[model samples]
Each structure stands twice: as structure tokens, then as C-alpha cells.
Target: MLEVRRRGLTTLLGGTAVGWALAAHAQVPEKIPRLCFLTFDPGTLTSNRFGAFFEGLRDLGYANGQTISIDYLSVEGNGERFPALAEECLRLKADIIAVSTTPGAQAAIAATRTIPIIMIGLGDPVRTGLVGNLARPSGNITGLSLMVPEVATKRLGLLKDAIPGISQVLVLSYLADPIAPLQVKAMQEAAQPLGLTLQVHDIRTANDLPAAFDAAAREHAEALLTTSESIFVAQGQRVTELAARYKLPAMYCFSNDVVDFGGLMAYDVNYSRVIRRAASYVDRILKGAKVSDLPIEQPIKFEFSINLKAAKALGLTIPPGVLAIADKVIE
Candidate 1:
């Protein structure tokens, strides 16, 4: 009887040990997915683009360091650092990569074909050779495009309408942006029909801006027109200060960046929508959606904003016709 009891106890202990082992295995946590947001401008942290993305993540049941690990990476306005920044993302074992600028997108593409990349508001992805086509972005990269080249003519017209006889206009293009040359070309082409002379100067950094303005003055540019580059967006206030000093009427890419910063005017696509939509793409990719399956998105909403106060500062009057059409007018 004693021997039989000992054997039964040993068998029960063995079963309990097996159960505990299985329970521990089941309790093992899954690896958290990682994301990297690479960009050229770090100043956009307080901008609408940044707010929309993080807010979207929160709405999608994601909390940083809990459900997902996100690294907000920026080159601090240095395009040359894109490759290094992208490599850093790879080192972090990022499952998904998001880029706000074209250079960032290019670097990410160069870094990895397998890692899915989400691009936000590229001017012309097709022309830039970022992907094969929008419909079937087969390999890895995909996101929102504003098709900025299409609006080149319209932006010029708005500036001309706001300040008549703007024959000589300074085309403030940031060549460091990679896509700025194409944008400058579009503006040059658009200038032909309007009888406007474009003084295209490459603005590489904020320090170079004073020289660019000097070029504008030398070329006899009446008004300043900037491409949809983040450099200008980041340096809007400073640009406007220079414009104000020279009494140079200016038109920019975003409404708040212009009217809010005491600048002339802006006609642009809805950037917040494009940014938030990009965030949605990130969420989808993290949830096991293939980049190839996700189609590229285009913006439908556009905004034309004017600032009567800034116009007053420059001693210019916004035409009644132009003011009537403006979506947002700051007085």
C-alpha cells in the first residue's frame, strides 16, 4: 500500500509540473511592432502634420511603448543625413517606416525593400520615380500625394491677383528638398502664360535665405513665391520678416503658416487631411495590411487664404475679386 501511494504521488506531481510549463509558455508576450518617422525638418513637431499623426494613432487603439514603439526621427533640415537616419530606423528593427518628405522616402526605399514605407504629401511621386504607379504601388512605399505641380499655375494667379503688375517674381525654391527643382520647373512653365519673370534661386538653408532675397532684389522681383517645401514652411516667419523688410509681397503653401505668421497669402491643398490619412496607412500596415494592397491617396480639399493685416503691412491691397475667393481671410 505504501509503495502504491508513493507511485501515485509521483504521477500527480509530474502532471502538475507539465501544466505549469504549458501555462508559462502561453503567457509569453508577443513582440511589439516598431515604427520610424523620418523627416528633414524637426521644427514640424508643433505643426499640424505632427498633431494629426499622433492623434490618429491614439484613435486607432495604439499607445506608444505599449501597443507600438514609434521613433520620431528628423535630420534637422539636413537632407544629407537622410540615409543615416534611415539606417538608424533599420537598426531599431522598425516594422514600418513613415516619411513626411520625399528625401526621407527615397532614403527609406534605398534602405529596405521589404520594410513597408508610408510617405506623406509628396508632390509627384510618379515623376520623381518613387514608385511604379499609384494604383499598384507593388514593392514597399505608398501614401498621400498633393500633386503640387498641378497647382503651380493657380498659386501664381492668386499672387498676381493679390498684387497686380507682379511681373518679376522671386521663385524661392529649396533644392535640398530633392523635389524642389521639379516644382521650380513647373513654376517656370506656368510663368510663361502669365507674362511673369521668375527669378529662381536655390535656398539651401535659413542662412542662405538673405542671399536669396538679395538675388530677388537684384533680379527686380516684385513679389516672392515659394514652393511647397518644408524649409519655407519651417521658416515662414523669418521669410515673412524679410519680405516685410523689403515690402515684398509673398504667397506661400499653407494658410496658417502664412496668415498666422504675418505673411501675405497662401493657396494649398488640405495638408492636415493628407497627414492624417498617412497616419491611417501606418495603422493599417501595423495591422498586417500589405503595402502593395494599399493604394495611394490624393487630396480633394484645397485652401486659399489671405491676410489683410499683412497686406496692410506691405502697403498692398488685396483685390476685391481675390478676397472674395479666399477661403480664409485674416484681418
Candidate 2:
């Protein structure tokens, strides 16, 4: 009798343990959501914007191999490769697609209308016709915008401030990017008021960058302002080196100019903040929130970063007032 009582107690404890295990497993879903990330700039998985965004995802309770799995594909400055990459992501049947810039977004949208598409660090989505409007993006696409037209003018103004005698401003842009034309228009409008000669140059490939800089120098551009596209950001070091080599005062639209060893002043959106905000969007979507219902967001925190070291190298003195207002001054 004693032996039977002991056996019965053991059986009851084993059954309770099994029941608890089943309940826990039921709470945690079996299949993890797979997210696909496509970028125009091909950089290492540990660095650059994509890496930062990946880290952001982990902070939001979605770590790779745990809750969410990511399939990352990069085009590495090849526009032609975007379509094929987008198609591959769709073929994987990604739960959500995260893309950078206008071209990448278009490719993802074309690949699948049903899957939610999130864009990071893109210019005016409405003007580019990526979405219907900012307040109500009535589609599967919604994310962040960098506030282009106004931001363009501010970059020029900052360049002028850096170089006081700046009579000519050279603008470097990517022709294929839809935001380029709008940025150019804003730069022209700002130039008219300041009496600054605006020389716009189009660059399609990385090899063309040196020649474009040479042209800007030959034109006697007193200052330079480059756009914040993936192409230029990918080649941040090269662009900054050239700008310093030419001794031309250059302002960029990203912190990479200062942090990644390039350019002088960057009056642009706070990128980490943008990526963190993107994580929030991703989290909401994963929790069954509609992408269309999550209204697209614009950056509220813009950063002004100045490299005093780069400024000294170029023989330019940064105005004290600008330094006073700068969010970061790299000595």
C-alpha cells in the first residue's frame, strides 16, 4: 500500500509538470515572424544604418533566432539589382519588409502589395508618390521622412556660415533619386536670396565622384553641400577626404560625415532616433497593428554636428555661434 501511494504521488507530479510545459509552449507561438531588410548601400552587417536598426529591433523584444528572424539583402549602390533582391524577399514570404530610400521602397511595393513595407531615412514620400499623404498613408507603405526641401536650404545656409566669403556653392546630387530635383530647387531658391551661385552636378556612379569634385573646384565653388543619399553616405570617408584634399568647405546631411570620418558640418535628422522610431513601428506591426493605421512619422530631433578638427584642416574657422548651437562639436 505504501508503494502504491508513492507511485500515485509521482504520477500526479509528472502530469502537472507536463501540463505546465504545454501551457508555456502555447503562450509562445511556434513560428517566429520573419522580417526582410533591403538596403541600397552594401555595408557590413555590424556597422552602418542597417546594423543600428537591427540592434534597435533587439531592444524592442525581437532578437534574431528568438522572436523574429531577419533576411537582409543589400544592393551596394547597384540600382539594377534592387528589383531582383526585392523579388527574392517576397519569394521568402516575409512577414514585413523594411526598405531604405525611394528606389528600394518602390521595388518592395512592386514585389508585393499585401506585405507591409516600412521605409527609413527617405525623403518626401508624398511628392515621390510612394504614399497618398502623410496623415493618412492609405496603403501597405509607411515609415519615416527626413524633411527634404527645407533641410536642403538649411544645409546650404550652414555651408555659407562655415565659409563666410562663400560666393559659389557646389551641390552634389544623385540624378536617379527623385528627391534630388526637389532638393536642387530648394537650394536654388536659397541661393537667390543669399546671392550665392549654385552649381548642380549629377553623379551616377562612385567613379564619377572624383571628377565631380574636380569640376566643383574648377568652377571655383567656395563651399560645397552634398545630399544625404545612400550612395554618398556609403562613400562618406572618400567624400570627406576629397573635400579636405581640395580644401573646400563642405557640409553634409548626415552624422557619418563627422562620425564616419568625413565632411565638416552635418545638419540632419538624428539617425539613431530615426532607427529607434522604426523599431517601434516594427513592434506594432508584429503585434497585429496595421501598417496603414500607423501614420508615417517625420523627425522631430535634428542634429547639428561640427568637426572642429576637419574645420581646422580645411583652414576654416567655425563661427562661435554655430558651435554654441551645435549638438556635438568634434574636437
Candidate 3:
């Protein structure tokens, strides 16, 4: 009878231990956070921009495949596909949806109200109606603003400085972009004070590019300025080539790649830095911080890059003042 009781007690104790271990295992929360990254450009995920974002996550103790999973979706400049892509993310039950452009953010906002969205490098969240206010977004959307309208004036001023004698300036922009009209208006207002003739050449499609350049040449345009649209960005090489062919001194926003492709200059926000900063928002949101509580951020640092080679090719001398203030001068 003593042996039987001892065996039964041992068996009960072992069962209890097993049950406790199982309970502990079940209590361990899943550590992996799933992210859905949406962009207008299909190449964004592989570009240095998203690479910076990934690096930022790594800095915050999040690994892409191990601690987190990222789903990349790109519209490839097709705004029509945004809604479908956003819906797909929702169907996958993504923990967070990160968007880079205005259209993509808008789609994400329309797709679902519950899924958190981090808007990166957007022009103006409030003006675009992506958020209620900058200080308090009051919704799921909040991240960094590129300040495109404010910067548009600065870019126009820089172009004027680069080509002081340039009387006829052509503004190349995408007509469909929501921020394009604001930028064009800013350029128009800034041009009045500078005593410059600003002509608007809207490119509705890639095929419209050659005609736009022809129009610029026909108008005797002395310089060119472009809006920061994903279509233009994706066609950076072609734009730079056309500028070179026409010998038009061009100023672009948000792309040093254009300068590398032999374009004249670019003054825009530090894209990589903004994207890295966006990761912090993701980190906070993942940690149970409310999106409305996190204030929208504006880029504090801007990059001014000039290619001396391109400037020399155009036979235009960059002002010493402009060159001195440039953050990066590529030879």
C-alpha cells in the first residue's frame, strides 16, 4: 500500500509539471511583426530608400525575416492599382501598412481604418486630407512630410540662382499628381518677384515627355524645373537624357540619381534619412503606441546636390554662393 501511494504521487507531480510547462509555452506571445510596404515605384523595395528603412529596423532590434516579416507591393506608377494592392495587404491581415507617396497612402486609408499606416515622404498630410492635423493626426496615418510646396519655392529660387540670366523657365510636372498643382502655383508666385517667365508643361504620360521637351525648346526655355512625382522619378534617366540633348539647365526635386545621370542639380529632403526616421514610427506603433498620439514629422535636413560636370556641359556657371551652400557636389 505504501509503494502504491508513492507511485501515484510521483505520477501526479509529473503530470502537473508537464501541464505547467505547456501553459508557460502557450503564454509566450508571438514576437514577429508583419509589415506591408506599399509604394508607387516597383523598384522602391530594392532601392537604397527601403534599404535604409530596413537598416533602421535592424538598429531597433528587429530583423526582417526573423523578428519581422515585410510584404512589398508596388503600383509601378499605376495609381489605379493602389486600391487593389491595399486591399491585398488588408486581406493578408498586415499588422502595419507603410506607404511612401500620397496616392498610396490614400489607398491604404480607404482600404481599412483599423490597420495602422505610416506615411513616409508625403507632401502635406493635412492638405492632402490624409490626417486631421499635424500635431494630432487623429487617425491611423502619421509619419514624415516632405514639405514639397514649401521646398518648391526654394527649388525655383535655387534654379534662378544657378541661372541668373535665365528669363524663360519651363516647369515640367505630372498633371495627375495632387502635389503638382501646389508646387506649380508656388513656382508661379515665386517667379513673379524674380521677374522670370514661368511656362507650365504638364506631362500626362511618358509619351508626353518628348513633346514637352520640344515645347520647352520651342519656347526658348533657358532652364527647367520638375515636380517630385514618382513617374518623373522612375523616368529619371530619360529626363536627364532629354535635358542633356536639349542642353537645358534642369533642377529636380528628391533625386540625386538625376544628377548622377548627368542632370544639373537637385534640392530636396534627405530621402534616406526620412525613411530611416519612418522606422521609428513603426517601432512605436508596434509597441502599442497610438498613431494619433504620435505627431507627424517634417524633414529637418534637406540635401542640395550639384553635378559640376553637368553644369559645365550646359555652359552655365553655378554661382559661388550656391555651390558653397550645396551639401553634395559631384564631380
Error of 2 at 146 (Å): 1.2
TM-score of decoy 2: 0.88
Candidate 1 wrong stretches, greater than 4 Å: 1-27, 43-48
lDDT of 1 by residue, 58-172 (tens): 7887788889888889888888899999999999999999888888898999999999999888887888889889998868999988887777678888887777777999888
State the local distance difference test value for candidate 3. 0.86
lDDT score, residue 326, model 3? 94
Candidate 2 stretches with Cα past 4 Å from truth are: 1-29, 257-262
Model 2, poorest ten-residue lDDT window? 254-263
Report the lDDT of model 1 for residue 285.
88
**Selected candidate, larger lDDT, 1 vs 3:** 3
* lDDT digits (tens) for residues 154-178 of candidate 2: 8788777767787988788986888
What TM-score does model 1 achieve against the real structure?
0.91
**Candidate 1 lDDT for residue 8:** 97
| Candidate that would win on lDDT | 3
Tell me which of candidates 1 and 2 scores higher on lDDT: 1
Off by over 4 Å in 3: 1-31
